[model samples]
Structures are given as C-alpha cells and as structure tokens.
Target: MRLELLYFFFYSMTVYILETNGWPQQGKHELRWNHSYTGINKPSNPIDKEVLEEFYHSTAGPAWLNNAHWLSGDPCESKWYGVGCNPSGDVVELDLSNNLLAGELPDRLSNMKNLEVLILRHNAISGTISPLLFTMKALRVIDLSYNKLSGSFPPQIELPFLTNLSLSNNQLEGYLPNHWNCLNLEVISISSNMLQGVLPNGLSTLSSLKYFDVSENFFIGPFPKEYSSLTSLETMWLFTNRFNNSIIPESWNKLVKMKNFQADSLAGNLPELIGVNWSDLEVLIVVDGHLTGDIPESFCHLKKLKYLHLFRNSLSGPLPKCFCDLPTSSLVSINLSYNQITGTVPDCFDNFRDLRYFYMENNNLTGTLPRSLSACKHLYTIDVSNNYLVGSIPSLYANLKDTLNWFELDNNRLNEIEDGLEDFIVTLSTKFCSLYGNPWSCPLPNYFSGKEYCTARCSSCNTLEQHSSCEKCLTSTSNCGWCADGRNCLEGYTNGPYYPYHCDQSEWVFGNKTNC
Candidate 1:
C-alpha cells in the first residue's frame, strides 16, 4: 500500500495541474487584478499589469494619472482621474473629459468592454469612430462631444444599454438612423450635424427618451403626429432645421414634461395657453421661426417660467401686462430680439428683482429707455441695442453696485455716457465687461480705451487658445466663482501669478465694499 501511494503521489506531482484561484495573485510574478479593487481602486481583470499601463498611456495623460499606485490590480481613488470600477477587477467607468487629448482614438479600445461610462469630450481626437469597438453592452454613457469624429454612425450598431450619447460638434454626416428600439436611451444629442431627410415616425415611440436633440440638421416637413406620444420628453431642441414649411403641431401642447423647449422655424402661431400645461416650463425659447401674431396671453399661467426667448420671429404686439408681472415674479431672462414689437418696455419691468438678462435689441419699440428698469436689483445682464429708445443710460449700476456684470446698450439713440461710467472702467481693468456702440463724447470717459475693447474682446488671435463662449467654465459645474479666487475655480482665468491664487483676506475689501 505504501509503494502504491508513493507512486500515485509522484504521478500527481509530475502532472503539475492546479485549479485556477481568483484574482488576488498569480504566484509572485503574475499579479491578480479585477478583484472588487474596491471596484474603482483596482483593475477588474484582477490579474493584469497592462490595465493601468494602457489607461495612462491612452487617456491624454492627466496629472493625477501619474500618481496612481497599484496594490496588485486595484487603484486607490477615482476622483484622481474620473475612473470608476465594478465589483470584479474590471474598469467600468472612464471619464477623462476636456483633458485635451490630440490625435485619433486608438483601435485597441476594443479591450474595454466592461466600461459603462466613457466621457472623452473637448479633446482634439481626429478620425472616424472605430468599427473594431467591443460590443459595449455595458456602456450607459458616452460623450464624445467637441471632437473631430466624422463619417456616418455604424449602421449595425449594438449598444443596447446606452442612455446618454452626446456626439455634438463632431463632423458626423448621413441621415439619422431610421429605426431604433433602444428603450433605455434617455439623452441622445447629435446637434450641429449635416444630417438630412425627415425623421422616421418610429423615433416617436422612444417613450423613454427624455432629451432628444437633432438641432441644426436638414430635416424638412412637419414633425410626425407620433411625436405627441413622447410624454416623457423633457428637452426637445429641433431648431435650425428646414421644417419652416411644416405646421406647428397643435399636439405640441401635450409636451407637459418639456422644460428647455426649443422648436424654431415651424410656420404657425403659438396655441393659446388655456389648455396647454406649460406649468412646469422654465425656458420657453422659440427663435428665428415664422410664428406670427401677438405673444400668447395665456403664457402668464406659467408660474415657473424663467427664460422667455422669442427672438428673430415675425411676432408682433405690445408686451402683455400679465406677461410682465409673471416673468417678474419668477423669470430671470427675457429676450425679444429682432422682432417687430412696438411700444415701450412695460413700465412694470421695474418690479423685476430676479431679472438677470434682458435683451429687446433690434426691435422698433419707440420711447425713452424706462427709468424703472433701474429697479431690477439683481440685474446683471442687459442688452437693448438697435432700438429707437433714446435717453441717458438709466444709471442702474448706481443701485446694482457691482452685480452688473454684462451691460450692452449699444446702437441706440443714447448720446452720452453715464456720469459714473468710470465704474465700467473697473470692469475693463479686470476681465469681465464689454461696452461699445453707444455714442460717447470726444474727451473719452475714463479708463478703458477702444483699444481696450480690441484687447479685451476675444480677438481672433486669442480665441483659438481661449474658449470663445463660456464653454470652458460651463463644461465643469463648479467652476468660476468670483467670491473664491477665480483662478482656483477656472483654469485660464487669473488675477495674479499662480499659487493657484487663493482669494485671501487681502482680496476682500469688506467694510462698504461687498463682493457682489
């Protein structure tokens, strides 16, 4: 029996076969990865060294990407580089947005099938999307915005789990996909595309789609009646299309969930707000459309209305007294640019305290600028250009102090600058003001030259290096706070040399000077 046992043991040792243990370690040389790695702190493969290596190599190489330490296969933190992980050693999220990676996406991306969220926005990646991608079954969010991706989206696409897909600012062409049964897709943005042809009727069946933007496309004809079924739709931006010949569907009033509703160029008048349930509507923007007739009187029902943008349309009539009262109660912005509305800005505008932005430029409203406008205490942005209104500037800043950040009263009949116009000088001294086009006296006001305008305005030379719009700060939610050092909050904004410039006690002059 001893001889038989010895022989069997020797045979087993010679075979050297062992069952695979989970990702912890593979002997001393082979490391295990993809363990819970805390799901985020480690690679999911649980047994590979190349995961982090590939991550840093491919993702624009952010500063924190260098500090990542690997304890076996797990990383230590996600806020370091927008990395997320699942229970296994797999990387489930990678959001290296606006990190400015240059060049085309590498084809080796097929390796990350476990990724659920992939945000690679504001980079300079050029080239068509790779067909060699992993089926990406787990991908829920994909934001490749402001990149240089061109070519038609793959027809046989297989991303069933995708929810938020923002492919804006890319050069993608071809008609929008006609059929998609993706029940889970919520936000799909293909704005600023060259896509042509009518939307397929089947698209309206995507009841779960909350935000669908096909703006700036070549789509023509009436929006199909089926669009009314999208009861869950919240933000529907269908502007700048060739649908001017189409009738504004009366069923549009059913978009009760619509908040940021924008649909311009559909020929017709707005329906009366009596039966319309725009009660939850915050932003009612319809610009450059063919809608004519007076501003809807029933619009006063929107107690929640904040922004009312009705620019570049043929709509006529005086501002309704009720409309002024409600917007004053709740609205922050009111734009009626490029319209034929005549008569004075409702004197009731004086009651608006939340009014931040007010633009009635290029309208035929004939009268002196209302002195009551000065009463909107929170007024920060104002543009009343190209109008027939004549008066010395209302001197609203005397009351606002410094809350007035943006003020444009250009191309009006105002013949003189304000007495305290030098205060605007302080704005030009820093980097937060724009004033021009109003006729000023020869012995030019105070600080801020026309050259200052030339320098301060985002010139063609500086725009490439700098963001033209607020996009730089807008992309990041917590950026650009004036109370704290703006340099600390925003990357490009600087008041002084970098220590990242924390707004110390010295930056504040409290007693009488408030930091508005």
Candidate 2:
C-alpha cells in the first residue's frame, strides 16, 4: 500500500508541472486526468465556480470577442479573460467593456458576492437589470452605459461602498429609485433615459455626491430644493425635460463648487446669487425658459466662465457694461439671441482674445457695429441680423477675413461698406453672408448683381404708409425718415433724401437722432 501511494503522488506532481509550464500536449493529458479533481485547480468555494460558468453560458460565452480560456479551465487558476479574482479565489472584477458582449445579464451574477467593479459599458446587453445584482455588498463601481437596458431603476439600493454608477444612453423608463441609501456614492448619471416624476428629496442626504445628470427625460415638477445640500456637486445637467413652470431653486446658490450647470424650459429669472457664489462656474445654459429680468451684472464676477447661453427667453434691458470685466482668457461663446434685450453691442470685446462666436440676433438693439469687435482675431461667426444697426461696415472687419465664416448683417439699417473691405465682404458673401435689407450707397462688387445676391442692392427706399410716428418711421426701413416741418415721411439717407421730395435737410430726423 505504501509503494502504491508513493507512485500516485509522483504522477500527480509531474502532471501539475507539465500543465503549468505551457507543455500543451502533456497539459491536455493532465487536464483529462484531473478533469474531476477539485483540489488546487478550482475555486476554493464551489459556488463561485458555478456562478462564473453560469454567467459565461448565459451571456453567450463562445460569442464574446475575447473569450480566451473561459469554461475550459479554472476561472481564477487559469486566468480567464476579463475576469479578476481576490486572493481567496472570489471573483472581484469583471471589465468587459466594448468587448462585443451581447445578451442579458444573468441573474446568477449576484453570486459574485465579492465583486468590487463591474464595467460592461458600450455593449449590446439588453433587458431589465436584475435587482439581485445590487445586493452585492462589495461593489464599488458599476458602469453599464450605452446599452439597451430598459424598465425602471431597481427599487432599493443599499450599497455602502458604491462610488460610481452610470446608466446613461439607455432605454430605461419609469421614476428613479427613491430608496437608494448609498451614503458614500459620489457619481450617479442616468441621463438620456425616459425616467419621470419629481426628483427625490432623499438625494439631499448624499453629501458626498459630486456629479448628477438626469437630462433628456420626462421629469416634471419643481427641482428638489433639498439637493442644494449636495455642496460637493461639480456638474449638473437637467436640460430637455418637462419641468414645466419649475424655477431653479434659490437654495442652489449654496452649491458653490459648481463648474457646469444647464437646464431648459424652466420659469423665473436667473438668480443673482449664482453669479455671486459660483466663482468657479465655467458653463451656464438656461435657454427656452420663461426667464425675465436683466442679466445680473454680478455675472461679470464669474472669471472662469467659458460659455454663456441665455437665448429664447423674455429677458430685456441692456447687457451690463461691466461685462468688459469678464475674464478675457476664458470666454469662448456667447448666444443671447431671440430676446427683447435693447442696447448697443458692447464695444468691450477688445480684451476677448479667445472669443469665437458672437450671436445676438433678433433683438431690439440699435447702434453702429462696434469697431472694437475686430480686436478678436480668432472670431469665426458674427451674427447681428434683424436689428436696427446702421452705419458703414467697419473697415477693420477686413482683419478677420481668414477666420470669419458666417457674417450675417441682414435686415438691418446698414448703408455702406468701409472703403478697403470689398474683398473681405466678397469672401464672406461667398460663405454665409447676408446683406439684404440694407440700402447701400458705396458700390459693391459686381457679384452682388447676381440673381442669388439680387437683394443686395442700392435702390431708393419705397415710401410706406405705416410710418405713423418718427420712431416707427426710422425702423420701417433703412432709408425712410421723418420730416418734422410738415410731419411727412420720406425716403432719405442720413445726409438727405435721394429725391429732395418735400423734406428740408434741417427738418430731417433719422438714423440715431430721435428729435422728430
């Protein structure tokens, strides 16, 4: 019996050496010999092996892009692809992101009790997430974004160690889970989903939260003012939702660490305290809202601001002159179009060295185009169309010939182009230039005679009966002026009428002169 035992021990030791040293022919023999052996080649706990094999089979193991040694050998002992294990042989991490992983997550994945990270983003995995997966106590990160997962969020989440959870770009619907109590959680993004209902006030307890996004959904009702308690928040996106009649919570001023904040279709004026408190703010977009009131001058204090978009609102009043104090090095884009704001474009742009886009179209602004705008050497778009701006186009605009693409001065009261800018205007018109309603005196290139540019003309203005008042007459068209002597309206340039038709030169009141 001693002789037989010694021979068996020697045989097992030789097989182990050959299998582990890449001797494939001998290793295959060893695998067959130890196919049922559960000592050194299998998981310490039998349940872990069963769970891993089940997950492989349920998720279509053979079809995976990188299914190296899955199911053919011990998961932990043979180093299966994308599988990680703790020293005790428990599965700890499974990162198969963008690995062409398809099919639904097997319910048995919950058996990975020791899993700390599960990243399966950018895959085709579908079906509702199993609630059992959240029961894993050791989970620290879970990113299943860019998948086809649907159904409502899991009802209860009690993970104490989870720090990141992203389910963006999914088809999930229904209200967000309200019972989540992940105290240490820091990032939660469920944007681009169909979730609805008022934001849960319970999220106020997540003091450690830093990033939260729920945009592009059907969520309605007032934003949770309690979320102001998340002072650690750095980014928040709540746009493209149905938060009808909801106003930004005034308490949000307490979130002083904010770097980016965006929302749409909300009601109420922008809170002044946001500019006062959020000194680190970089991007602020609140478009298509019922916002009314002057843009707070305090916004000039946001020295780090880069993008400012407040279009399609009822906001009126002149832009604050203090905007010249805005950080020149950081500002990039500004869009305040489709509002009732009235004032001359601020010539404070000389210091905006990095400015690119400037859009203030469809406003009530009246003034000569500021010569200071030419100081921005990198400007790409300058759209001030549909306003009451008049005067010669600045000759300095020729400096932006190479960078400018979309130059729209259409439907304005502009009359002439400065002498040396013909080439620049020709180049711009070939792009997105619009110089239609203006009555030009200086000759344009023959290019304007083309049918496509027929509206770009120097014709005498036609008289209209709608000029009932001097102010109304000036805005009627570029050439229509009010004659004070006889209270008559006639077509004329700032110097005098083209036909000298019953209007004395001294009695003319047009252009910027309000004395009719």
Candidate 3:
C-alpha cells in the first residue's frame, strides 16, 4: 500500500490545514480568504469577515429577530445566528440575546478579537460603551443588560477575563472604576443605573466575588469596611442607594458567605454581628433606613432565615423573644412596618410552619391578639394595624380560614369578638376586613350589621346626637356613652340605647372615656 497511501494523504492534509488556517503558530495562515476555499466560502479571518460585516451593518441586521446565517457565508461556517466559533474559526460566542438588536455598539466590536461570550441582552442597543469594547482581552460574559446604554463607567476597566458583568437597565451615568481589575469577577450587576460615587474599596479585591448588585444607583459613601474582604460574597444588593449615612459595617461580620442582603437608604444598627455570622443568611432587607436599636437577639442564629424586611426603621425594643428560636420551617415574609416597635406579638407563633406575609404595621404593639397566630398555616397578609392592641379578636383566628388574605385590625384598643371569630370575620372582603377603631358592644354585633361590615365607626354609634363634650362623646364612638349629666351621646354602658331620663347611672362614662 503505497506507504499507507502516503500516510493517508498526510493526515488529510493536516486536517485541512488545521481546519482552514489556524494553529500555524496562530499566524492564522496569513489571514486566508482569496477564493475557492469552501468551508462555506469566507471568513477564515478576513478580520472575521470584516467584523461580521460590521456587526451586520452596525446592529440593524435587517431589523434582526434572528437573521440566521447572516450575510450569507462563513460566519463560523455559515451558522451565524448569534455566531459562536472557536475550533479555531475564532469568534467565540456572541449570543444575540432577545435578538431584537437595534443599533449602536460597533467600534467594529473590537474586531471580535477572539471574544468570549458577549451577549447583547434584551437588545435595543443604543450608544456609548465602546472604548473599543474594552480592548478585548478575551472577555468572559459581558451582558449588556436591558440595553439603551448611556455613557460613563469605562474610565479604564481592564476585564482580565471578566466573569459575568451585567450592565443592568441602562442609561448609565458616571463614576465607578475607581479601580477593579476584574480578577475573575463573579457577577457584578450594575443596577438600575445612574451610577454615582463611593463604594469601590476596590471591591474588596474581588476574591472571586459572588453576585454584587449596585442597586438603584446614586450611591454615596461609607459602607465599605473594605467589604470585609468579600470572602466569596453571596448576593448583595445595596438598594435604592444614597448611602449618605452609611453604617452597616460591623466589619460585615466577616460575611460568612452571606446569602441575600438588601439595603435601602442606609444608616444602620442591624448588625448584631449579623446574627451570629450570617449562617448562610437568606434574605434580610433593611428598609427606609435610619435604623435604631434592639432587634438582635443574635437573630436566633438565623438557621436559614427566609425573608425578613425591617421597614421604615427607628426600631425599638421587645418583639425578639429570640424570635421564638427562628427556623420555623424557614419563615416566609415578616415585615416590621413603620417601626417604633414596642412589646408583645411574640407568642412564639407555634412553630410558624412557613408563615406567609405578616406585617406589624405602625408599631407600638401591645398585648392581646396572639393565639399563637393559629400556627400560621400559610397565612397571607395579616397586618397588625395602628397598634396599642387590647384584647379580643383572636378566637384562634378561625385557624386562618383557609389561608387568610389581608385581615388588618384597624386602629386598635379592641374590645371584643371572640366566639368562633364571627364566622371568620364574616368571610372577609369588606375591602379585606379592616375593622375600624374598636370598643364594640352596642347591640352592634350581628357580624357588625353589614354596612359592608365595620367602620362608619361600626354603623355610626347609635346615631350620635347630644355630645356637649367628654371629648365629643368619646370621640363619637367606641359605642358612644358619655353623659356627665346630659352630655348625652349614649349608645351603651348603664344599658344605654339612648339612656338619659335625666342622666344618672352614677354619671356614666364608658370605654376609653375622654375625661368627664
């Protein structure tokens, strides 16, 4: 056999010249392409076919919605559709995400230069981010997120093999590049965009960072206790930024691989050593910030906490009976609303059992209402409204009548309503059951005589009439009753149904009486 057919025709002509010119010391066979070399007739690097025909005539590639096999030839052997080359055909991954790629982003896309994953995300493109595409150092995932990209941030970014960088919701403004050499960054999402200064302690030198989102944007100062050296951070989104009053850096309790931390309008104090070293924290959002004391019984050591939003802060004491030793099947949604928090509400919700949305609204909370939250059975929206809570409403909350929805007890100091929770508050939905300013007990409970149930001060407290003052008959109705001798707005108390007969019953003055 003629020497094995000349060694099988010199190994199929050295694999067709290393797949048509590449690897001859990478001189790419002197940039071939001069006819009859069919590998779909073009691009063995004619500068990647003139930068993919100038990125398909600068991004409008015939109003692309998948301009498949674009420009008709060898964009990586004619399989163009989001071109992804590399077996030495070179162009490596340019996924045209959401392919409606509208214009701008063609500084000849830095002539592809062996791109490594450049996804034009949710494209509608738009101007400004082509410092020659950051001089292509073989990028690793640069997702121009929800594009419409505006200028700034590129006062020198080197990308040393970037690992996931998403330019979030663009219109990007300046500041942010105070030094970060990528160092194999792991997800940096520039959020909402309009970027402002501070927050660059050189990103705590990356250390293989893990998901850092510069939220909402206008970032101001402080929060950088050198980011406690990232230690492989896990999901951090500094929300609605304006870090003017910084604070959260109890040396970030050495991040212990934090899992989801959100910050808004920063000031601080929730750092009781991050609930004993993060313990793989799961979602903690500090809201409308200017946070004050308490809240930290070392957060019952997190045991995988699930969503706790401390709202409108100025936090005060009580509420943390070691949060009933957290880990009640990973509690879901607890918002301490408009905080000024005071005691009560901690009846250790009988092993929460995956509680769902419970907000302590307008806090100043006081006792009564906790039949251990009827063991939560997936409760949905239970707002403890304007608290100062006094007894009555908890007839074991009718075991949340099949996953309750929005049951807010309004302006509290509640008087009564216990027997079988009045058919679960009359099958909720008088705008989701919001019983007004309590003190009930005036022949008024036939499920609160449905004037669409509760509030017109519970059907106008027996038609309030002669109230010459006792603060206008107890401010008109916790069921009236005031008569210090004919100040008469009587509805109850001393068996009132309009009791006056020359008013006396020991000068009546019932329920929350405003001094007579």
| Candidate with best TM-score | 2
Per-residue CA lDDT of model 3 for 320-399, tens digit only, reads 77778888887677887878999888777888888777878788887788888888888776888787776577788888
What are the lDDT figures for the candidates, one per model? 0.59, 0.75, 0.72
Comparing 1 with 3 on TM-score, the higher-scoring candidate is 1
Clashing pairs in 2: none
TM-score of 2: 0.80
What TM-score, computed on C-alpha atoms, does each candidate reach?
Answer: 0.64, 0.80, 0.35
* CA RMSD of each candidate after superposition: 23.1, 17.2, 22.4
- Candidate 1's residue-wise lDDT over 1-516, tens digit each? 974463344223212211111111101111112223233544346322255456465545544323344333344333234566665656776666656665667665656767777777767777887756426678777788778888776554456787777887788887766666567878878777677788777677677888877877778877887888888887777776798747657776677887767666656776774225766787666766677878777888777777677776777887766756475666777778778887778666777877766778777675667767678887765667666555465555556546766665555434344677565546534634433443233334445455574122221211222222233323333223221222112222324212222234433222221342
Weakest ten-residue segment in model 1 by summed lDDT: 19-28
Better of 1 and 3 by lDDT: 3
Q: What shift in Å separates residue 306 of candidate 2 from its native position after superposition?
A: 0.4
The per-candidate count of clashes, in order, stands at 20, 0, 0
Which pairs clash (backbone N, Cα, C closer than 3 Å) in model 3?
A: none
- List ranges where model 1 is wrong by over 4 Å: 1-43, 46-83, 100-103, 106-113, 131-134, 156-158, 245-247, 273-275, 381-516
